[model samples]
Target: MTLSNSRFLFSAAGLALASLLPEQAAIAQSAAPATITVQVNKPGGAIPKNMYGLFFEDINFAADGGLYPELVKNKSFETDDHLIGWKAVKGAAGLESYIVSSDRPISATNNHFLRLSAKAGGADAGFVNEGFRGMGVKQNAEYTFSVYARRGPGSVSGMTVTLEETRRPGPGPETPPSGQALAQAQITGLTNEWKKYTVVLKPSATAARARLKLTLDGAGTADIDVVSLFPKDTWMNRENGLRPDIVQLLKDMKPGFLRFPGGCIVEGITLDNRYQWKETIGDVAARKPIINRWNKEFKHRYTPDYYQSFGLGFFEYFQLSEDIGAEPLPILNVGMACQFNSAELAPISAAKGPNAAGQGDEPTLETFIQDALDLIEFANGPATSTWGAKRVAMGHPAPFNLKMIGIGNEQWGPQYLERYEPFSKAVKAKYPNIQLVSSVGPSPDGDLFDKATFKMRELKAEFIDEHYYAKPEWFRQNASRYDKYPRSGPKIFAGEYAAQSVAIASPDNKNSWDCAISEAAFMTGLERNSDVVGMASYAPMLAHVDAWQWTPNMIWFDNLNVYGTVNYYVQLLFSQNKGTSMLPVQLPGNAKNGADNLFTSAVTDAPTGDVIVKLVNYSTTPRAVKVNLAGAKKVGKTGRALVMACDDLSVQNSIQEPKKLAPKEGQFAVSGSTVNYTLAPNSFTVLRIPAKK
Candidate 1:
């Protein structure tokens, strides 16, 4: 009773659905139908609790504008261009100028502040903040507007903040407000010393592209910094929190772990710009901004204004992992910049000297090692510990229960090996039980990647991180990629992977149905090899519709709303149905996986006492599959199925039509120990049947 793109026409004879086409009839007459057997009683191995998870990186506006929920882009005026998101709005008679100044600012770290000088006070004599693709405000929804301000040699005794609709002017000129205010709030007190101010404004009408205008109350000068306009409604209703909708999408997956901070963002363009976990931990305002590594990385989608404000920093990452009930798997910079970038690397030790010539003020490998140790302390140490004390001060007294840490993000060769040896040793020496995930470079399979994997095995690493970004066909063809991997060596962590509809990193890449179904086919191998493949997650978890620099993302969102792509549903079905123990699956003809364009894996959920089977039909024809749950006692008469299918492979989901390619749930009857189900064409289906050993 599962609804999908492909269907069967019942015949009076009940022998076949309908008269098959010439080729199909020939095939049906020549051979028997495909049969899959799930050995329910013979569970192969215990599936790791954290097998399927999310890999989060700050690319494609995934953090600042997308998930962090801070509508104001350059809230702190600390970007290389201080006025990146701010512009002056001159009145007919007042408003002299606006400049970013640093004299006696709010703090040394947050040095830059916007100083506005005006000859007179008026509604138009203010500066407007062009939010992240314009603010997304809802009707009657309260927004918390806050700023740090002080008097600056003027009669400006107060500030007027207005949330107004933005008018789209022609190019070159600054975008101006439409003069109609959606919400308004006023701050009356102005002190000589820098202090934070807060006010809440409720919009009378919803405006997706609204702007925030802050004007002077009197003719004078005033300084303002850290201006933020955040929605009052957030995940858990905590201040400086994440967008509830996006976080809800993540939580729904029931992910095992949340790998954070980055893919390449951990390895910056230069050693100096590398992501420093310590810097991302303390006061949100004090955390300085750095140019995002993805900015201008692709010439086709050049985003010059992309910067990391660290508002959604390490503390928030750990907190978010906890909120989503996922183990925090933090990846740290391994004393090296991105191999694709400048390839700057830090020395193994100060005594050993710089690895490469012309390296500038790079912290030694010991610094990176110490950072890893301190991160453990920050995550799991006692309150009396220095780093744990800082965590407690941030309202999280209990440890985040962090387990494993990734050393490098896609690094390879002798450089990675030499540095990783000491790094892993140091971490193990301090915290012997802590597992480490070492890198095997960016490519899924290559001479260098294989060499790196060999080296990691030699080093006796806990996990070898493998990454792959390839075509849809590659994923379907490589359904058994891990079948030949040895079962006794270091475990495998498929750290990052996605099926590209187009070329890898291409601007035209899409989150198409074909890619999603193909990934599901490939993931069956990972599930089958759970004894060796411990963890896996899709890459670049999120992207903004208007501000994205990358494609093929799992989730897409705008300033106002969010939606999961077709690939997201595929991932959701797998993660949510990942059973407790692996069940052996036998395919018809003793053929290899992906044989005849059909792929499958099975598992048993001990808690629910259900036999779970996942099947993928990559062909354009309906497939009647008979699943024999062998050695089962008390098989329920009915079972549930979650299916996602599309006749067109190119179909995708958008913000307006979020569920255009979503999963459908239905129930099917089971005859004794056998379940017969017809999989729709180009579909990924999961069956949960109640049973007992």
Candidate 2:
């Protein structure tokens, strides 16, 4: 039997055991039945439609290997080492290869390409590229392979490209295609001028671990750049697209908003490396590549080759948000660098001469403010405008209709506010309708957080972004964190949050049931105080199994498969079942405010007129509760229950056992005005009941 069914069946035994002990029997009988009185007639407040969404950061290889879906890692040979992801093929010692830099490159931003020189009769001389955790190929699936090549010096023949499985063989009755080629294609034409060559290959067999090989047939020198391989079936079938599986997962969640290109990346280690939105748009070839700030943030999990190709840039983010039916929330740098890093400041002038106001200074705070204004123009300005014309040239003639923009990502202190004040004012002055989201720095408990909150409150900021990565216990205790906040102050956006199984950034952290359940408990409070909280989302959305820098992410994936964590299901449950209006739910004395580890919140869907109640039981023993639909005209006899329960808190979902902690659906009966249900211990349950007219 499934975990939910077993828990439902064992409730009788639990009661029988209680009857065996006099003290327990008395306590159970005198517990006032743990009544949950739901006032269905009156709606307290309207919940934000974009309440539960996603916060996507480029950390943990989330972009390159996880979501962007480009099979080749170093596609442009722009890494510091140039040949980071490429290697010399075996038996190809006759060929010499090095990086060739040019003053005039394919684009001014990208200036490196592989130069391979081969001697006569060196047919095996070529290069092999190890894709991100090896390319995943399926039987009869079509993949597009392309390369930018130019013949140089000696005469050369065409190049041959092949996809082959490189995994070691294991013990099995059926022979494995370990060393067999799944797909092969040849490019015959190579002129003296640089040109892009394209070919399509259909893999004859499926392989979970594969590599791409490029072999030059004749003797000569060839220059190769921007080698790329992609499956034909991308999301929306768009060229240079995202992984369908990952995008599908986000689409399935029905996310209300997508906060993109973020986290510490918005504020780079220094001012020079900050994520400049202008550089990420326009021609993909001209878009400059930068080393990912997360490349070496943690010495223990250093990834030297991690870089941002900006293939998935601002325009793509907006398009993705549109495709997924989510609101696009793009955050820009606010003149200050990452506080944890260099903390460089943009030039500020107070002089009184020709050099006054830093007019001649190449880069100053004024220029930074212009970037923000240009971004707004790029997103929502008319197509005739300069920045908007660029957007039109990029195939999006219509505006993204961006209603909100974030000024900074986790920046705080006087320096942050000093920079943020001017940027926020300028953005609001030019685009008064745009809602600006301000930051509260890294933690929720530090003096920096307090100072930032005070400043935003003084400024009457519209929305304040708070972030936290704490233990499960902290989440459970902070369920009422926003309960006491003044309703007149700035609204709250739980922008970046996830319960860490271990301490923050620990490599041992896992997306365990303990963390998920605690987050569920806390989310009830977020739902309870919907008026003050405008939005919330789980952070570090995607992580690669082999190239991860952080743990406890919402989704985990390898080359061939992807699965949502138990935490993901928790967010999914809340997001998918978000109701239109909040309804008051009260518990009996002592059991109120989750004193007994039982948390509950109620909401009513205006369209369906269905009452949705979410309950989280953090105790170790089952609790039988009476749900009284007080003030309801009529309660349906049948209702639906979705339960996510597990036997142990430490048990986690993995690639092999992806559904170990998934939700189970069941039916329940509700009589006239009351429904008695036994909530499984350490579980999250959602009940949806139709209200008769």
Candidate 1: TM-score?
A: 0.95
**Poorly placed runs, candidate 2 (over 4 Å):** 1-32, 90-93, 121-123, 168-178, 350-362
Q: List TM-scores for all candidates, in order.
A: 0.95, 0.92
Top candidate by lDDT: 1
| lDDT, candidate 1, at 239 | 91
In model 2, where is the ten-residue run with the lowest total lDDT?
7-16
Q: What are the clashing pairs of model 1?
A: none
The positional error of residue 215 in candidate 2, measured at the CA in angstroms, is 1.4
lDDT score at residue 689, model 2, on the 0-100 scale:
82
lDDT scores in order: 0.87, 0.82
User: CA RMSD for every model?
Assistant: 3.1, 4.6
Question: What is candidate 2's lDDT per residue for 357-440, written digit by digit as tens?
Answer: 234544667777888889889988888899999999999989999999898889888888888888888888988999999998
Considering every candidate listed, which one attains the maximal TM-score?
A: 1
lDDT, candidate 1, residue 382? 88
Q: Estimate candidate 2's RMSD in Å.
A: 4.6
What is candidate 1's lDDT per residue for 132-210, written digit by digit as tens? 8888999999899999999878799899999988766524364364657888889888988898999999999988789
